[model samples]
Target: MAFSGITTKFTRSLVIKMAAILKDRCLRRIFKKIDFVRKPLRLNFVTDNGQHSIDKLLVANRGEIACRVMETAKKLGIRTVAVFSDVDEQSKHVKMADEAYHIGPALARESYLKMDKIIDVAKRSQAQAIHPGYGFLSEKPEFAELCFKENVIFVGPPSSAIRDMGIKSTSKKIMSDAGVPIIKGYHGNDQSNERLKAEAEKIGYPIMLKAVRGGGGKGMRIVWKAEDFDDALESARRESLKSFNDDIMLVEKFVESPRHVEVQVFGDTFGNTVYLFERDCSVQRRHQKIIEEAPAPGISSEVRRKLGEAAVKAAKAVGYTGAGTVEFIMDKTHDFYFMEMNTRLQVEHPVTEMITGVDLVEWQLRIAAGERLPLLQSEIILNGYSFEARIYAEDPDNDFLPGAGPLVSLTTPLPSRLVRIETGVVQGDDVSVHYDPMIAKLVVWSKDRSSALRLLTHSLRQYNIVGLSTNLDFLINLSNHQEFRNGNVNTDFIQDYYNDLFPEKKSLSPDLLARASVYLILLEKRKQRKSFDDIISPWNLSSCFRVNSDLSRKISLNDGYSDVEILLSFENDDSFKIQIGDNVMKGFGNLEINGSQKLLKVTIDGVVSKLNVVEHNNTIYCFSMEGNYKVHRLIPSFIKSKCEAMNLGDAIAPMTGTIVKVNINNGQTVKEGDIVMIMEAMKMEHVICAPKDGLVENVYYAVGDTVERNSVLISYLKEDEKN
Candidate 1:
């Protein structure tokens, strides 16, 4: 019995030891798996190689850029602080920030460009970083250096990169050294008029004059002939002085067939870099881009590779970090020459993001926080095509002159995962003349270019804005242009296809006019019904109401160019017999109210048409697939006659601006096509010329005085009244 008990004890002990060994092996494997999956958590902004954390960020800019940065910062669990000017107190960015500080006045120089003030705000807000958006102090190396000295992070490239790239003369030298193709231009330190003239002569006529430190199409002009050199130089200088505080100019040979293409490049402090692909931004007016697309349709893979390599080389030459765009001007043969490098994020960066499916802003933050690049050159693949159409408060028919006013009624297409509307203003927001006139950026993406274009056109048609003129119609027309759709794009796309793009005068269709009339009548009835006690009120009738009898009333629809007279016989509130100048039509319409917006569903002779309608200040603005139409309820006969006859042939200011120079005085004789004065607005010069041969009756403004738009800057004396 004793021997058996001892054997049993030994067996139990062996089993226990085996179980312990198994548990030890399982723990070792689990720990090894965990070590394989886990990564070192570190932020770029942390000192000593990401040993600290960034708690708050301060945005030292305004408008869309400010809002854009905050969106990414919020997503990454970083609080954002905003600084606004007096004019931007109620801006979207200010409202979105966790905390906001008033920086300065409305003018950019006094507010957004005040680097010292911005730094002070950052310090006071206890922010660890300052994001200078594209404009203002974004490219200022001094600002970046100051941020570094203050021990605050600057969310852009190194100060050295900005300094070297911000100056065209310096960048050209660097790019040339880096084997990047450069246009033959005189980028020297000589600033004398004689020297500049000599350089221009050497470069030959048709030279492109650009400010050494200019951006956004400002301080740039094309001189077609030697005779225009002096004027062009002076104009470029004045604009550069106002915009960049630099008047030094560079002259280059103007490439007749130039297309603007830029490659988005990103880098990390660890010496890693990659290109996010290219964007074709050729469609422009006034040297500013209007439409941009990614992957640059129709380019050979060889050219794409060369462009990307050159851009990466350019970035490396300057030790560039963060997001920077290398702009190139490619000729007909796809031979590209380096134009300039933007040291900060570009305004059209979204197109590249859409095509790559990468969040550039997030990448910027991560890079700034000391993180390595989240992508590799081989991994950054261009997927489908994408396009970005910039919607601005400018008139395309009138030279795209920027305008500013209230966005009285604003509505956009239904938001979706594919379609994005990026804007800083909302309905009832005022487009201040103190800044850029861009309203929003309409972005669409699809599996191919054709599908993306179709979506863009459809979305444009659905966008409705009233109380101010917009480029919506022009964008729609451009999207439909054969050349644009075929990818035959260039910088002069607008100028080259002006006739086809603007088309001849268009007359509203009878169906559209009838729908407008019904829409207006229904809106009025709704207003009356709301004012009364009953929701179902029979008293709400058409303009010419009669009991049990059809009444006919005349209504006029004018779209700024022509007028259409419509006679509508109302059988009831929902049915009408309409006659538009000789064409008769019958329609039954009903209004469906959708939260202060009215959608009119009308069937004209069994054909259904749906339009989005907004009524404001006695004007009914109707938007449909056909297009948008505005009809004033009351257009007196006298006003129409007045528009036809120019009583005094006065030359009025086309837009609100400062009178830079008055070329004529009272009693001066002037002939048609003669320059009478020059006005500067939105950093652009507009020449006012005489309309007819007559004596100047009055000069209402002086050289340094501001004037309202359409103000009579000069009036011609009547024939019989001239002294």
Candidate 2:
């Protein structure tokens, strides 16, 4: 078809425009979704009248999970109601709720776990649904049953499913019957101590004692020796009863060096189930996960398929109809045995969401609203690698001892499209004794495992917290470990690489001395400037400033584990020199303000170092690329003498907790290493031992009495000052 030049030009232009339209980025993405993703997961499933069945949701719990749920609910245009204990009224979750109700006191038993109180609040607030965000009543069959009776939607599995999966013994039996591999153990109703001990011996030593209804590492103990079986059983039972309100116990052979791999599965009321993927939660302390990632590393696609199928099978066996995790213990060869199935959302659910690009909470809400599965198993694609490092207010050097304190300073890695900071508290908030010590869950993702891991460690370094010991440094070290980078991980990772992870502090570096000196000098000038009209005023100056000579002063600071001494000299405002041992350096520093974040940048002999600093209670925190260092100013002897004298030989409460057992009475003699008392704090027990062999002069707190941290629990008679 011959045509004029103008017609040819128009024809060519039209073809070009068509080609461009097909290649346009936005259109390309839409076509990709049509071909690959099929359809994006969304919440537009309204009823026939364009109304959601659940208009308001009452979160029957507290902490990060509660806040997380509220966020999703709000995104779906659902009003959220939060229930809090007295101590949690000021918590982040409470503030995020549309309406909040104070349930009871500080103890969880009297508050969050009071199903009746929560149900009452739900009905009073006219909440159409109750989303028990993990822990508390999330797995309680009675709570689900109560929600059903009250005609409110329970955003979890059916009560029967909860009853079946909530108990490990029942869940194990069901898994075994369903042809899922089960581990060797006794899951029968033999609660007698004698029977358990006999079972442990028969199953052989090195058995695991787990609460029948336990989750989150609560009520779990490892008995390595036959002699320790009874004690382990008793302790496990006590903790189980306190945590789950059920003292039933289950025994299983402790799988040595196995990886704790779990698959995230979602089910709907219409009998549809899909597995998102699997997460490796093998690196842990106290048998609780510290870091988790998905889809599990070093896993073959065939094995992955098998894992997903088995997890789906387990969910089907229980007729689960919500978000649930099927946990498995995988050996070195990838052979796996079914562990207990978490009846609700797992603590590490964020990782699954990251990899699958699906909001499990949103799925729960939709399913509870009578919606079917959003996508088929084949369409649910695993796109990337993801990791979740749980930041906790705990002392890693002290066996990861749980801590309760004010978060005086909290500077976290900024959350992005691929990064999430799952938390329920903020700076200046207290980590209460009546709850979990986890500060937040730092979730990050990338295209591959290595990049995701690098991102994870980088984020952890920026996760700075002050006012209490934390495991941030430990996590950073663990993430960068050689074996971990190579995908060599297991439940014994921490134990296997303990030395590399917890290395002793090296001699205080010159950089540290310079940083500390610079912080003190600038801080002093700032304080003096605030106190008076001019910072340079002669009367306002509190430094070693002199007109004729370079004035020097001896300064001391405690670096958490030891005392660090520095001889610092200065002549003018920016003139300063710091000396530690034979090492010496000169530096001038200034502070940079970015919103609420303060960066202390110091140039020592021309090399500039930027640091995030937090000053609180005489302690100066310096955060750098290397690590976070805390230097506490020592109290001078003059003022120290004015305060009440502390007995060096007294056994003090290491944390705020109730005394669970007192082994020594007044006037009783104790050996140097004897256990003086045991206190329960933050769901873990801390033992106070005799400082030295001496007579117990006083027992200040009895069993069941709560004591403040650092308070003397027992006074030991010193040899020099014996009564």
Candidate 3:
């Protein structure tokens, strides 16, 4: 019986087999016309081959990865050419490169992914090699083919290898033929909806609809039941067409809580290959890896050997050369299956490098220069554990929505023996909505997985980034998770336990509060000194009230969700020591006494911190490393009684976005759940809906206008009045 008006899996499989027969025949014919003869080459870096020296290299991508490639090329005495879209002329990558060329408009399709323009720029610039970083045209076989035709070395795997692995259906067939275990699925070309439905039915409920030609989880859907097949199929097709220009999809059985593992492989022209072991990329959101690590924890040595062997077989099947990754889906049973092969360098290649002391990019360049594999498989060693956390310009609390704007403040702690940060952005750089939201990558290395995790967590907490929202807190929590620390992770681990990962806590402890107060005071003192101002007027002196000629005030703090409250007293302008409930915290520091200027140097548990106090109206604003806190000087009891409520009807735009679709009209009656407007920011659409049934009192702006954070969209009348 047919499901969702789609054909049966058996029929779809036959159609796929038939399509493969035809496609293979066509590919064989095409391959016959292409010459695979090795060219006579002279020694380059090893010997003085001046005529064959590569004068310039063109980077055929954008963003952090492009900048990274340019840095390596520049250090190697090569002139670097950066190709950019109209919107990226002033980008960091463009500024860092030796020369810049405008390819087209901002959209990737019109620029970075446009092979012809990229090739044209290379030819014009007289570049001897083209490096397709990680994304964009990195995996496209045609770009590599063009580079080969023009005699420009493609700093990646051979074009033939890319072609063989580019198509999912064909790649699966090749891997399966090569004896690699593949996940049960139908990798066929029966685009008929009916046929797809049948394949899904065979795969059983909870199947995945995956695009045959794309990564980054684009054009992918997980249908839990047969009834949801048609809608999912359409959605997957639409996304696939938009992302990869290919609507052909395959159905595979969904493995619940499967860990994502991949083995890094490198091959040389001398027919030698070595596996760099495995990296666990299971911590993901929306199928994009957020954290990755090498030498997957909790995995057995026997399993590692099996995975490595499988990856090598998959690579050898396509005659793979240069840097490539063989990804796999491992279930709880420890049974692994081939996912796909990435025929280019991975973004997380640094973690592998940290552990193995191997520079994969340098090896890529050397291999491209006709060098033999420096290390054999037996020589490859799995070293200590390493972890990488991808720092992105996105809001974790807001469903991890992408954030865009000028980076007002960006600072990372210096790299040490255990911590490393690879970033391409600088202060004042604008994070545009047109590209990926990643800002940098923070990597840490240690002798063991537990130690590596601990080091990474500490580094994240020490990192300070202002302006745009980030996943720093979430990452820290994830690193400390028991499951993650124990290395018992899978692709679904985050989704299944996200709520527990980010817990809602209220109010700081008395010691922490004391520390925060001191830190704020110090910060204010520094600012005042910088401004060379004394006795700053309008500073809230009432917040620090005097009792019996002593400049000290009693303050009450409460846990918002509970009735628990704690009282503590602080001196406004005196060095004081206090013992509260077995905790001895002291406020002692050099004080520049001035009217209305209250500063304190406090030591909590032997660690000194500062605090600054400023008064506005009757409220005191305290700024510290903990966060901003406001307290009333007149009514100290009110501090623990009620916290200020976040105002509603104050529709704040999620990010620095443009109003793309304005659906509400002024004075129009709308019910709750109605979408009033939609904003486009960071390449994603955000829908603003009415919070309750009410009449729209006003429309704030029109379409095509840019909006900042906290910008009001529309106001709604009271729910009772609307009814």
Candidate 4:
């Protein structure tokens, strides 16, 4: 009895010492609160067969999804391993993992998609399970089967379930047999051209032709007339073959102005399944979702029940045993039809988690370890509303084409209880051309839809990113759209409200220009301060203070709308008197930068703003709530002539992509609307057409050649010189 007492006292002292090791006070408190639920997995995970241990997990993916998965795994005290390609060696996900391994080259086909390499890494790392976060190998049945064979738990549904839901045609048939409403489509085995054409004729014009194995808006086309059917079919087939290596397709009647909604479902090995309400993902550009929200608005409770029940029924039919998303298209009469099943965690899962107060990844791990769901249908609570807006490195004015470059400056709102940020890149990280160019996701929540939307709008305006083009301004405009605020969501929302969303361009105001000029001078002062030799130089001071006289200077500012000339008279070190055209203003502005210079806190004319600044290629890019502006300190006397001479009447590449086809050749004469070439990027095709009637001098690139943005692909002889 004395020996037992001595041993117990030693164990208690060790526990106390371990608790004191957590240096962060807040983290220590959080750990204490979670200690109750962090009991040994072996206790509750044991079954009649044996004990399944998942102390370590390997994430067979990269980017934001991989980071998101690791967060929950770490919270549960599970070790994480990360694999990265050559380009992703310095990625955020790689840095977050407890251990990292080099996979392969920069291309995904050689790295993330290599099943053998990933399995080899998992074995070497001694991982007990593998988490295929979202994209790459998440939905591949073969990957899951291999993991099962290797005795490593796959933190997802069964392989058979993945196969059943992967193919659009097969999933549609399964849903129909399960008594779920399906859109009228031709999901038959007939692949011959004649049969597809006949099906289209039966369905009538305005048909939707989609590849049986496609996602992310690829391998899909909409036909409005009979004459356009053949071309659309060939284009869709070509893209399908490139994306999935399968050209099979299905035709359906195009449902106009329908809302895109999906239900989140989870199932366990115990055969219990539950649905977590619905998400409206109707705001899109080029058939890709840009904004999503939970607890779909303007829908009756009866309709909500139907959606949730249908989703659960679909999951049970496949014996799904993890998190999955079931998508549906709702028509004007509130009738919803099964579209397809994602068969994995979705990119917009955070919005659902915020409303339901559930951690989906945690549930995924528990279910994979053969544990019953922690909550039942009756226990799941839905409170408040949430919104998630996807931020991408793309130019909205250029048909929303994707962009690739370095993120020289990135400053986002601080994450808190009501706000969350999921990102994959940091300052100075490159947005590679080999993968999707999504920068991050901004999420917000509130007590109601209006309040949540208002918070989202405010957060977006405060998100400052520079050194590459982004769709930040466009997303802000979309959230503030009147129709969107009223919850009038539909597939055609963007097209129907195009005018209001993208109004006519407006020139920068005098006050805005003056503020930019003040910012430029402050940036120069900062540079001088950093140089030891110029710290006390008189030339570094403001123009007025240096000479004690009326100082005149002219600067130029461009915000992608119009260029303006600002006449500045420096009043003092912290203020300026400026004029743009006929308007004049006097304002005080001061810039306080953090250690890294990525975040610039400023106040101009009593309005405080936080801007992200990047000085590259002799130009200063200032990103703020007003908008993004590029300022040039010195102006050339022949600036107008220089700008006009730069326009060479050439068909330039809109973005970095691979050339797939060239329709014109040297010495070929083309009309104004003639197709010149085709380029593919981000899994979509873009057509380049002739700008005017002229003779093609030469084509710079051939098929399968990579090209950069704004590079001249086809130069044309001037119209006057053509004769």
Candidate 5:
């Protein structure tokens, strides 16, 4: 069957059942060969050889992953060396490392991808080992080989293992030869476009043009029909060249709605291998995993066994040592096929750790030091459910475009059953364009998948990040999705439900806005008290600061929102409730007053929310959620008049960026929806269009010119004028 057809039939729920059947068959065979001396196998890789420890290690990567590796190393009393580019001088990884080295320029090719410079820094810092941290040199066989030749331990799989699995085409062949089920595709090396097209025809439509050396969905395209093949192929080839510097492309059957499941396997020098169970990474966007979970939901015991055995076979085929992941595509009919093997630690390793209670990094360090696997496959158990949501600095509403700017405010809820934020970047740290936009990994664990999903959704709602766009809303919606809750997932889940998941614009309710305004006013009042000692008066009993303002105000609220305005009458200093229309909202807060200023500290829905109010010109401007809004303030008459008088042809540039393309010319007649210009900002192209049918009066900027925010790019005359 075609890959897409096979994948479309596969769903996460059905794959779980298939996994159980496979597991049973494999285990039964193992029991047949079991003897007193060969009853399965228990491998111990850690030795009591006086506890060998490396003094310091260099993290050859940057960003969150580097910080994550350093955290574990630090816990084990190991120092860390951080390598940075000119742009990363103030990066979180650089700040976290005990020692740092400047590599080269901001571009990755000149720094992070430069293995020689990284090694030189390690040597200069006297580091004993180097941890690649899952990008750049993580899966590069040459890097491990160089580290081995230099006598520095590579804190991952051996060079031989990387060589076998790092190359996708070879990895697929190796897995297939070892009797592992693999996706039927043209793995041949014929890079000619004509040959690829012929191969795609053989494979059937809905084919995927993928780069031989691609990750993160950069050099991949899905062609649904023959007519789209040529365009997709060209695009895939161009992206592959830009991303991997390899124009070599391959034609594969595109899997439709197939679940992405991978088994975590560990091996040691003693030829012992064990599988640490599996993780479901089916929830994705643009071929990048957004949410990951371990002990995959809906998979029966039978299918789990099959996946584990196949994963083990795939690992053995490559002589894999240390930590690695064997990925597979499973359909709803329980059919499974190997995708590829990742010869390094995965970014979602934290999910596995949460479920298994094992530190994969520490084990990787031990294995690289010539140790053997410590636990047998039978000893490993799948425990509770865990979910990991990657918090990225991107605008989910804007096609998930990467967001870059300083993190002005970051607040995470307390770690509990509902929330746990594992982040490296702190407030004030700049999210640069030099690296991936991911800022943190938020993980939630529970006794079951449903509970875990609920906990994740609640936690995400409480997370507050300002100054940069994030995918928080998208994650929240995904967690609460009907398909997700039922374990119905696949790679195309995002695209399938993009419209329902995100709306063009979201507005706050008027009552919620009013409440937010009140909170902001109170918060500002508190701030004024702190800065000035004479803002509050102490002896006025009626106006004296009280702890329970909601009770005193007698405010009634209906369904958390109110339409009727009710007079707030304070009954006491600490307690008050406001009755808005027929609903009342009762709340209390700790009152602190300094001179004329007042402070109210309140807790709402088990989370602390503070409100500060300052009165100026009998109006309030509330500052909360990192955005400021004026409350009860009259609009400026002059500004309102000017807005009312402005014409429809007015144009303004959205942001500071380069004018990449000027599509319009002076005196050119354009329709209402005609594209006038295009600008490139923050690596995304934004098009400026005509507001109405009119003649182009002027073209303010030419291609290759830098423009500031709100700068006029083009202007149009009246619609009646035909050029």
Candidate 6:
């Protein structure tokens, strides 16, 4: 201090170290006395000039959303760190990250939802920011506050915003005060069952019981009658606790013909907020959107402007920043109401990005860095229509029962400038039951709605997944449905067209039989050729020389219930004659190979078709326009007898899951269709019911116990056999 101009290097270093030490100690003391979750602890660790630059980021989630965020971060020249559970070590996200840290076991609560573990990983990886993807700790105010305490940027809104918008009652009151049309509901402090029942009755039957703290259909149930109120509330509470750690709920009037329309809004620290137009997520199943499109199809220009303006108002009211969606429910007449604001990016944000020609994730990163809004509301332009079909590993025909296993064969539509494929698994990766069943999202864009729908359906058909049942075919049907094509969609769209969507199976086509027969016969000869080891190949592969007839064999295919005999005759090396019953047809088939693609091109009579054929688990999967089919051949009696058979009167778990509730007790009489057990799998519940009237002979599983698929949960004695 006495001779600043003549200061030595040792003295300069000593002074700088003391300043840093004192700053750290002073900040810690101040933070300790503050309630981080309820206050603005937003501090810039990298810069103080209001704009921050991040060199590395940690993704605090898994699966497709995690991968989605990393892709954008990488594009921005930012290195990414991935935190994965044990099961996700081999996940696509882990493989794509610059560094990956194993957090915990397969369960999300023990891994992704553990704030301390994620924050620790970020610190260990030297990440400057944490991007909590759409789920997990994304909406938790505490997680955001924790990031604040650590001086790491949480790429989301402030904790105050998350708290204000996360609770339904708080958000409703805020929106109502802001002149946003709010739906009538009970948002009170009373938590007793009697109080909730009274509130629901006041709201009328068909009331919606929703978790106050979370979104995405978790802890949401519809009580259609007074008798169902208690059960629905309990179910909502259980799911709420598992997903959000909050069981507080609010009552709301269930809207009919409710069209789910949401507008994407973005903001920055500079107080600039804008709407990126709206997406129509009206077509949904299981209270979650399966397909989403933008901009919404039929709203008038005036209504569209109002919708966007209202969304901006909602975002601005909370001093929001980063990517957020303001969801609204609209009636048939286009009258809209505020639903809730998602405190993070939505699963359907791709539709918004497609139409806006902007990378929302990149926007989120820039905003978190204290940068100004990328584009103003007036500067933003709506480009075209886009649709996102969420491909899931679930049985669509089985009430959308979720399944888990290795994706023995997985292929997606080739990504292009106009088409995007968001996924986190590969051909050999397993889709564990510990996470969501969504396998990938197929996003397609076009200049108009009709063109986009066509592209969406075309892409859906191109997606071929084997080893497990999927919603690929169901998505195809949904995209091509007349009502959907006409933009006549609502939350009840799936229920309204159930019959058309899940129709009774039509008789197998002779054309398909002819093509399948040719492929099989050729496959057999190829195997025979392989056995010769390229020595006696021609003789064994060639048709047996015949004087007056061709070699024939009866190819019988049994689809579990019915049997169809296909008389296959080898006409030549590649040509075949397949006759079913009295109908006969000629076809030729060949396997065309290009890179990793295998296309089975076949001609039946004068018609030609190409099918994606995959052989997995002894089943030939044929995926085509008609639908996905499992080709099965009759097993020998001895082989069938060797397989273990399940008891006739036993109710079994539909998939590998934990038994959450066992409704049946030993020796207890129950009627047919009564729920025997409830299992939780793939983040949802499924009920196992009695097949007929019977007395429970034994209880095979109990609550909180995990069971494999087809494991008997309850063994029943038939009514006639009960003593």
TM-score of each: 0.90, 0.90, 0.77, 0.89, 0.76, 0.90
Candidate 6 residue-wise lDDT at 715: 75
Clashes of 1: 4
lDDT of 3 by residue, 244-346 (tens): 7889998899998899999999998778887989999998987789999998878899999999988988888878889999999998888899998999999
Which of the two candidates, 1 or 4, achieves a greater lDDT against the reference?
1
For model 5, how does the per-residue alpha-carbon lDDT over 1-723 read when each residue is reduced to its tens digit? 445755766765588989997786566444423311122112122223333346688999988888888887786677899999998898788989999999999778899999899889978988878899887899888899888777677888778778767567887888888999988889787778889999999999889887777777767888999988886786677666756677877778987889999999998877788888899999887678899998887889889999999998988877778889998998887678998788888989888877766778877766765655645676566668999999888777756766677776565657863355677688778877656778888988888989988888877765666666688778887888898899888887888888768755434344444354345434544565666666545532334543565323222222212223443444454444544446555544564556533344664323455544333443442333323333333335644654554644456676566676677788888888777777655434566777777677888899878777556677777656643
lDDT of each: 0.85, 0.85, 0.75, 0.85, 0.72, 0.84
Decide which is better by lDDT, 2 or 4. 2
Q: How well does candidate 3 match the true structure in TM-score terms?
A: 0.77
Off by over 4 Å in 2: 1-52, 527-554, 560-573, 593-597, 638-647, 720-723
Candidate 4 structure quality by residue, lDDT tens digits, 1-723: 355877889988887878775444445345433321343454244433466688999999998999999999998889999999999999999999999999999878899999899999999999888999987889889999998887778889999999999889999999999998999989899899889989999988788999887777888999999888898998899898887778999999899889999999999989999999999998888888999999999999899999999999999989999999999999989999999898899999999988887889988998888888767786676788999999999988888999999987778888987899999889999998888889999999999999999999888877777778898889998998988999999989888988888878776566656666777767777776776476557666666343334575667766546677777777666667777888877765567777656456555556677666766655677777666666654446555654764677788888889899889889999999898998888778899999888889889999999999888899887667766
Roughly what TM-score does model 6 have, to 2 decimal places? Answer: 0.90
- State model 3's lDDT: 0.75
Instruction: Pull out the clashing pairs in model 1.
Output: 43-369, 44-369, 44-370, 45-369
Query: Candidate 3, which segments miss by more than 4 Å at Cα?
Result: 1-52, 86-91, 510-516, 519-586, 589-601, 604-607, 610-653, 656-690, 693-723
Per-residue lDDT, model 4, residue 78, is: 92
The C-alpha stretches of model 1 lying farther than 4 A from their native spots are 1-41, 44-52, 531-550, 559-563, 572-574, 637-646
Q: Which regions of candidate 6 fall more than 4 Å away from where they truly are?
A: 1-52, 533-538, 545-550, 593-597, 625-627, 637-647, 718-723
In candidate 4 the C-alpha lDDT for residue 508 amounts to 56
Candidates 2 and 5 compared by TM-score, better number: 2
TM-score of candidate 2 to 2 decimals: 0.90
lDDT tens digits by residue: candidate 2, 323-411: 99999999999999998998999999999888776778888888888878767787677888999999998889889988899998898
The pairs that clash in candidate 2 are none
Rank the candidate models, highest lDDT first.
2, 1, 4, 6, 3, 5
Candidate 3: worst-modelled 10 consecutive residues by lDDT: 34-43
Q: Across residues 222-320, which tens digit of lDDT does each residue of candidate 1 receive?
A: 998888888889889988998888998998999986999999999999999899889999999999999999989799988999999999999999999
